[model samples]
Target: MTGTASVADMDQLGADVARPTLRGLGARWRQRRTAAAQLRHLTTYAGRPLVALTTTVHLLAGAAPVVFMIGTGAALQHLDDGGAMPWLALAIGAFLGQQLLAPVQLVLSKAVARRVDAACLTRFTAFALQRAELATLERPEVADRLAQADEAFEQWTLTPGAAVEGGLALVARYTQLVGAVVVLGVVAGPWVALAGAVVALVARAGQTEAFFRWGQLIRGFQPLRRRATYVRELATSTRAAKEIRTLGLVDWLDERYAAENRAVLDPLWRWRRRVYGVPFLTYAAVALAGSVAGLVAMARSAEAGQVGAAAVAVQGLVLCARFGVMFPESDVKLVYGRSAWEALLEFEAQAQHDAGPQAAPTEGRITPAQAITAREVRFGYRPDRPVLDGLDLDLPVGTSTALVGVNGAGKTTLVKLLTGLYRPDGGTVAVDGVDLRDLDAHAWQRAFAITFQDYLRYEMPLRENVAMGAIEHRDDDDGIAAEVRRVGLGDLLDGLPLGLDTPLTRALPGGRDLSGGQWQRLALARSLFAVRHGASVLVLDEPTAQLDARGEAEFYDQFLDLTRGVTSLVISHRFSSVRRADRIVVLDGGRVTESGSHDELVDLGGTYARMFEVQARRFGGTDGSSTGAGDDEMRTVQA
Candidate 1:
């Protein structure tokens, strides 16, 4: 028997499964590497005009610094030489370098961000699209990484990426710092060493706080922001709106969401305050040192009759110290940003690469054959409890087989195993005699057409829903019109504003919706469309539960005619609906416990026999009772 997997377990498992995927704990180091690689990758323009253009812009920006530095020195020299024109011209050029570089830098950053954002999303979505089911998505560790990407992927490149901002900020500050050193040497040589020492010390302190803040935001603080986003979705999204209003949950949800968001922000905000405070204190320290150096330089140069040069030198040193203090702070922020980007890249790599446990092969298709078989299958969602205890069953190809079972008897799991939707914990599930795991997944999936018990009613055109069953060839296939007619949905299709193309959703304007039975017909049509397009295996998994008695009888009676050359596996909880199958097998606790024709089972008085007898009493005679199933006739019980 299966161990009860709790609601919490199922929901939390996805995040747990995802946690160790990008296994290394060195997220900081990894982020720096990923950030560098991404920037390098984006900047790598091939041998062409584009590369030349990129180089040209950067070269011009670099040249501006030299021009400005020279201009500043020249202006100071001219003022000392008592030449007004030289001082005015050099001073104007100095300011021009400072002004022109700002806007050009902004444009380049914006352009690079756009490309990087697009590239990251395209790569991650490609990885996610390869997953076979939502089961893996349930793991929260993976969900967290996935959520990080979902939350920050676009921002990594599109938004003011910490890396880009930090990188540019560092470069700008460093350039100014170097220029200040040169100007100070020319103006106040005595105080140059003192200014450099003070600026470096302030920069080191800012870097330390930045490192701590990055980790805090990425792990401890980020989840609260994600929780807030979920709250917003619940409060306003269309699906949640009705529930929000009906249960009087609007204010409660709003408050909860607000609380969760604040929980995340409060720590970050406090940390930010601390960060700013430390900088302010450090900035004051740098200023105090600058002031002492300035006073000494001023007294000495004035006494030596060089006040103008001394003033320029002191001002230049002050500017360098300020820019230097900014350098390490920016570096830490950039590295933190890089960490977020690396997380996204690591998750993408794992999702795309983890195919070892799946059913698909790296080779050819599994042979199409005359039977499906499960040999000694033992299975469970988790390893601790056994859901299927060495179960075995076989269904001949080119014939219809029915599986009947009570709830928790493992009917649905059996269907998933048979369809290659899941792998057995022990033994193998086989199609046409070859084990399902050995077959290529793409081909294996293409071989079967299934109408699940919970089949989707997609909000698309009627024809598109049917065509989805035969996805690849849907564009050129017009014979779906005939299948629509066969299912008696022809009127529904024709009566719509647009034949076959009418949107089957109540949410859309002038669109129509389907009742339970009508949608079953559409699902049936989807199955037929699959069969028409070369699917040999057809599976009906209790989706016909909504069908009236006559509708079901018509389906069973014309079963072979409808299926023709297909291999059909039918699942029904009600034995009467499935009694006509060539064989009926009873599943209990995930194993095939009984097998025989319906009449034979009834005589044997097994699970199938008891279920048959229960429904048979409803008809008032012998076989089973279902409205308009037949007039005093029972479906055959084959042996």
Candidate 2:
């Protein structure tokens, strides 16, 4: 079950089929416990005063129904006597109390709900960010759980006022039922009361189970909805608009979007219909039968003089109210809320388990002043497909080394391991002879400045984007501007309206977008800024992929000049850019196949020389244009 292999296995079976296995009473108990924990956690944020006020108000309001019923019955009975006005007053007072308290409770409940939601969201997001391991975040199961928890929270926490009121009503309804049955047990008979109570409880249990089952289906359905949303966005968003039109794929994309929507919603509809069919019908049948029988028994008692007309009316009222508490809106709300709470707890547990060792390093944080070495490193994103196997590499201090490899040769994986973003499954990544696992993670990260091929576009102010590399320099405009100039963005900045303050995306007012090459330059500037901030190691994974050959060569020349004494690892497809490195290592099948200077590798005439020759011939044509024969050769070599 390590890595993504289990995720693939689960995906093949479908998330719906591989749903959580907890069942029956155990599942119900777990859900209840989760809900209780959520409520308890919310109080930490919502404040005790608000919770107390809301509970008291809702409880009073909820109990009003039963009180009003009894008051009305008593007042009606007292009509022939002189005591009617006082009884009437009692009923009116109770009614007014509910009315007066409702708006206040609702307002307080809403306020508390918002605070609780903010607290939960902030804590959950922080927990996800602060965890030391990236593997948990990379897991599909963990991701889905997070999404489900968020959805659940949003759906339920928004209507705190309603939830409070509904919960109180449920309690009040059950209390009234018990009281009614007790009265019947005395007047009608214990046997009749026992039968009615049994039927009512059975119906309630069935309805609860139905809602729980529906929640499970909805959780499983979330992935499908996400897929549908992605497809729809691709069909409609401006990013994909050009491709859709140029490729004549507008109709095709629309069809795909429609298919995705159907794929998500069709099963949902079926599940909903099925859920509302037999299980709900059974509840309805039991409820109807119990209500009718209870009413009939009450009427017979009145007719037989076993009870008064007021008593009979009270019994009937309680019977009707028993079914009233089975309101679908409230039940569904609780189900969604509880399900979310359960998911949140589940994810927290999983993340806690995945967290790295908590013990402080005995040797404290060690800076990598000498070199970083991976000895017999092993890693895999899946159980069966090892991405890096027995990888042994060294990033020597104070030198530039170029890593060249074909696709799937573990070049990027090595960079990740070296940077300590991922720990190898076996063996060791050591910095200055100290294992990475023993060093302080934050200090270890500060040792390297890395830029991956798929770098982020922050869509923030241009200054913040570069300054993010070193937060202490975030407000240092002069220093940021200096880095910008160094990266050759001075002319570009001069053209912008707000200069460094301007946002990178056109989505914001007064913002402007940069060309891909410009962004790549900005990324390099950020990395250089990190080095300026005392980072000892600089790693770039396909940093010049967006640049032309000339641009890439220029970047490499500048890179070497800027990082003259810093330990640097550069991965590039261009041989010209990589050949300038002090040392070049050719990786093939997760192992270093050749290690030497470019001339030495070429002289060896191994895989590196073959690749170099292929790329070299692409530029070595007769008329400054690559020949078709060379293209064929490249394709043949690559294949």
Candidate 3:
């Protein structure tokens, strides 16, 4: 009874082990099928003719080895029979064909890879730009996925294009292996062929699994890799070069880079060591044993006169070919490339989820007729730390409003909400009486031309830089030139050798870099150009921050003219620059604390009044007597 119980227990354990093993195999099979389907889809991007040509080349190349082996065996048989030289000639031709087809296959494969890569890049860019809000791009998880997708363009990294090409090549290799196995079975015996094929397949499976695991490991470390990459960029990039050197941080950056790199690579290195240790040796031993067994079987058959010398030779070649195709380079490319492709798909899924349901397009453009108003608006970058809490404000049409606040007072956050880049967490932003959510986001955004505090300085031609504000009107050279002059860039334009055609960066030949003041003027000109092209609302956030005192004063002098017939919102710390605004709103503690013209606010002696008094004292202006009161208010606010 004890022995019977033991036998039953052993049987149950065997069943339990077999269950998961079978399930794992099933899962792997499904994954392979999915990979093959993806490969086929990507290949279509290469165009039918190129794909067809590439396929033909790969197949012919795969068959060359089989033809060579057969021809050599036949030639040996003919020689033994004292027959003609035709078989020998065929053998030579096959060998030459094999050699010649290799480079052609490589060239064709790369061509297909490049075409597929270009199509994938375009698709990626389109997907990234599809969302109307900036929230999706700002998420940490989405940023990590973006880094993974970006790997496709980096050197030595796997891409979807490479995966498709590798999949095709892998198929060709298996075709060759299948042909060799069949030829071996016919010439030698079924048992011998089966033994060799089993050994080769087992070894290949083990290696492929190792690589697949490595690919997954690499993918899991993408965030760490991005961190490491960022550190490396800080050490190497031109943007950080001056700061890094000036701060004497070279050694510190180097150490940081090393630490970040180790954090990413140490686990991968350990994995590689384990995989390449016992497992790799075991596979090598299995392959060697299979090769020896096959050779011995073929020799014994020859000795027994069961097969001729040619048959023995053919069987020997088949064994070598079978093992040769195992542990292929194509497996590495396919596995790693598939990981990158999967990352892109995963990003798309996550981004779609983050985007929620798409809003149906509202017909016609929604322009502000009377006012752009925020009613009890609330927003926060993080859930627990609200930036704008129940803030209410309004910008009437054809008037200028200046927003003033301390550093963390949510001035920029309010602008983002009003411009529809971010939706309020609560309440609503409205155009006239219409809620912003009801309006088409793109059309609403088009109604306003904004220049942010940190505006982009594109390194394109001068014309292209300004025309970026309204690209459809890029060819309107007269309008572009007029806007340039209107923004006080006439002298800069005249100094340029190519006028509007001069490139903005000195990195190019005949290109020139601008002074900070000139770049500010150019940025303003871009926004003004947008206004000329039908944008009726203008938003300027510290637009003159880069300009000198004279430049700032000049900008203020033209402020009314620059914003003529358009509703404008200006955000600035320079109270003097915005004193003439039709209205001034002071933001504090995530809410509007004061609203009036500059003189009215000063007379009220609130947060805005105290802030203006402090600035006036610092600049040796008139309001010296109120300095002590202003300082007391600022200290209280800071606390």
Candidate 4:
């Protein structure tokens, strides 16, 4: 029973083996199809003239060696006949042409490669921006694909340019191989040519299969590579420099980078050893045996006068040339380049899925006539942890509402949901009774002007930085200037060498970096510029955190005038700032725990009142008229 299987069992075992083989063949066919499509795509970017020229050079270069061998062999035959100058000249011309073509091919390939790379990078950037929500970008799988697509130029990786170039070279290699086989067949016999062809192809196929397996293995390590790269970046980042030096974390960071890299490489090394060892020896042995047998057969034929001197010479050269086609560099480039292309395709598919269906133009640009409301909204970054459960809130048109909460109370999360940056896990955020999901995401986001705690400090001209808020109206120079003054950045702008034209970061020539308070004001100007260009809703989250007490007070004094006709939501820890809003809402346990005017909430003596008292006591007074005390001292005084 152990030694002999029934017919049904045999059939099942055969089916299993055949299934995997068929699947492998299907995968290879798909890979080849993808490679062909990518080649055509790359050539389109490289332009027809350049591609044509490069291809012609590669083919001629590949055929040059075969021509040289035939010419030399003919020259040797003519020497016996005492007239060899023409044949010798032909041989010399072919050799020199091969040498000269090398540099020409290199230059052309580089040019084509650069153009293809630029086009691919541009497409990648466009794809990244296609997604309407931020949640998809944060997914681990998407991030891994992004990293893989981006890091195609590493030594271990292959760029699209390299892949296309390798593909061309592979075609040339086969040309050379076929030319050698044909010459051998004519000079010797069909059997010798067939044997040589078989040996070369089998060896090349085995080597190619090994490289393809290696590529597949490395693809699984993309996440590991991403983690390692992130660790490396953290160790070198300017933002983290101060903390790293203070904490003496250089060695710790180095260890972490090494650990992450090892996690990727150890398995790779083990796989290579197991996969490459025996197969490599077998290929080498086959190549060696085939070469010796073919050479010996030609030598015997020549000695017996079965073939002429020219035929003998041609056979010898062709035998050697056939093995040269088995060079592994082109194969490696093709495999790695194909892998990079596949990564890009994978990312594109995910991005399209994340973007979902596109809404019609008219239906997309919805504006709330009465209110934006959240009803029973539930959300969390992780499934097990719920951040906002059954949260309900309303922002009435043309009114200022302040949102107050302790840390981790989902104030920021709520703002994100309202702005369509993220969707709730359950329930709906509606604009004047219309669910946000039914609206065009871009148009919905464009309706609000927001300033967050961690606003981006763009290292560009100050004019461009402010104009980024509403790019279509960047030419409205007067409006830009007015908003600058409104945000209290007029003096800073006047002091600049080029005024609004001056670059924001010191990294550029003659550029200046602003202090934290000035940058905060600049961020405010950017958001206000959006309002000036027709953004109907204004959202400010810790907008004045970097400002001093006087600056904060000045901002609050102008707040009502700034947001007079816009629906506004301001999130701040300061009771003074919250008091400036028409309505104050306290967020606790993912719900609106308190909703009233600041004075009303303070009078009610609930969570908002207790928090306001604690903050006010710690600061001595909200108006900065009294000396502030430390946390422990405030607690002791209260006790």
| lDDT of model 1 at position 298 | 49
Would you list the rank order by lDDT, best first?
Answer: 4, 3, 2, 1
Best prediction by TM-score = 3
Report the number of clashing residue pairs per model: 10, 0, 0, 0
Candidate 1 ranges beyond 4 A from true positions: 1-73, 76-111, 131-135, 153-212, 221-228, 266-337, 345-354, 357-367, 500-520, 546-558, 616-639
* 1-639: candidate 2 lDDT, tens digit per residue: 112223234244344432335564686788667665655665567778877776676667666655665666667667776776877787898889878876876676667666766666676777677652678877766766677766556565523323333443354456556665565565556545765686667677766666666777766666665566567767777787878899999888788888877766666666666665676777778777776676666556633342234364545345743653456435765666555555666787887787657436334224567888989988998878888888888888999999987767788888888877788899899988988887766667777778888888788999998987887778878878888888778998888899889999998999989889889989988888888887888888888777765676567668778889999999876676688789999887777868999889888988777777777676793222221223344335645
All candidates: CA RMSD (Å): 7.0, 5.0, 7.5, 7.0
Assess every candidate by TM-score: 0.76, 0.84, 0.89, 0.87
Top model number, lDDT: 4
Residue 289 C-alpha lDDT in model 1: 74
Ranked by lDDT, the better of candidates 1 and 3 is: 3
The order of the candidates by TM-score, greatest first, is 3, 4, 2, 1
List model 3 lDDT by residue over 398-438, tens digit each. 99999987678899989899988888999999988888877
Off by over 4 Å in 4: 1-53, 153-157, 302-329, 361-366, 472-478, 622-639
Q: What is the lDDT of residue 574 in candidate 3?
A: 80
In terms of lDDT, model 4 sits at 0.77
Tell me the TM-score of model 3.
0.89
Q: Tens digit of lDDT per residue, candidate 4, span 493-594?
A: 788898888999887998999999999998999999998888899999989888887888899889999999899999987777878899999887889989
lDDT of each: 0.64, 0.70, 0.76, 0.77
**lDDT for position 573 in model 3:** 76
Give the lDDT of residue 171 in candidate 4. 57
